[model samples]
Target: MNVHITLAHPEPTSFNGSLTYRAETYFKRAGNNVTKTDLYASDFDPVERGAHYKDRSNKDVFIPLGEQRAAWKNGTTPEDVRSEIDNLRNADLVILQFPLWWHGPPAILKGWFDRTFPSGGVYTSRMRYDEGYFKGKRAMLSVTTGAPEEAFGPGARGGDPATMLWPLHYSLHYLGFEVLHPFLAHGVQGHGYSYEDHGKAECRLAQKLDSWEDRLAGVWNEAAQSFPGWPDWDHRGQPLS
Candidate 1:
């Protein structure tokens, strides 16, 4: 299978980056074609503005969606975005590896969603949800958290994992991917941030890496997380009774 891993951590030696590397190696060892994009290492611009669009559809106002539509139509989509899109186009499974910062993804990864999935090129009103362009593709999030696993759940201190991850999972669903249950590694404190003994923390993290590899072996056969599709919603997007 073709796999694409997108790493959104700033430090290449970070635990999040290690997960990305492990995934790449796993796929390659299995004889699958693996590709990767390290957003920080590549210095990917996460901001979307008029600067990205060379040939503007409207010079007076810079509407992001409008410019995207025009660019896709005129074949003037920014080269970097186009390249990222091409990577997605070739992948059977797309893994997003990132740390949970401020209870959400890093700005760079979010911007990848903004730039890579062009308006007219990837989605339209009629082409979203179950009918989105990437209908047959699969996507998963491998998230790392600083708090312990016990701190996350409904009514927990770190906030519920389901609630924290909903926006991202829904966004992938919007693009028509079969979104998998996220793989979460908690207690991922960096130096000087440990809640427990440093030696114990290191040992736990090492075990988590092994667990990650084991999970990947059967990732394809796992059922995707349940999500409301077109059939579940009315024309107004409310849940059907």
Candidate 2:
């Protein structure tokens, strides 16, 4: 399987970076083809400009977005964004590794979505709504949190992680991907957790990955059964399929 791992942390030696490294190693060791996108190290542009709007009607309008996303799936896109897109497009699974800063993905990763997920870039006009270009893909989040797990519960100070994660879950679900439960390492930076704690964290993360790997693959295969079209339903209506 082709798995794309996108890292969003800015610091090279941070715990988030270490998690990404371990994830890559694990996936590769599992016999899957792994591609890593270090958004910060790549100096990716996070700002969208007038050019993005100017070429809307041009025949090559989708070119830039396509180039930016080329590497995502399997190197099928052209040399530009194609690498990133190919990585996304051809992957059997996509693992997003990042720190839960301010309760969401870092700016650059968010920018990646903004730049890549255009109306015609990934999803064609007809395929909008329930159907998306990335339909049938499987995605998982591996995040590191500075706060302890206790702070993320239903009645805790930080509130439920599920609530904090709704945007990401809904986005993937809207794009027709299956959302797996996130793997979170809490209290990584807090007092009492020593350097040796990282080893335990790694083991926990590995166990989570091992437990979900087959289930995620199953979800991807199931997602592929649907046509690339919106179902006959509304927000208040029941799911058609």
Query: Looking at candidate 1, what is the lDDT of residue 15?
Result: 90
lDDT of 2 by residue, 50-82 (tens): 353422433454555543333233333323255
For residue 179, give model 1's deviation from the true position in Å.
0.2
Total clashing pairs for each candidate = 0, 30
Clashes counted in candidate 2 amount to: 30
Q: Could you give candidate 1's per-residue lDDT for residues 1-241 as a string of tens digits?
A: 9999999999888898778888999989999999999999999999999999998999999999999999999999999999989999999999999999999999999998888888889999989988988999999999999998989999889999899999999999999999999999998877413477988877888888899999999988999998888899999999999
lDDT of 1 at 75: 95
Q: Lowest-scoring 10 consecutive residues by lDDT in candidate 2?
A: 71-80
TM-score of 1: 0.97
Instruction: Give the C-alpha miss distance for residue 129 in model 1, angstroms.
Output: 1.0
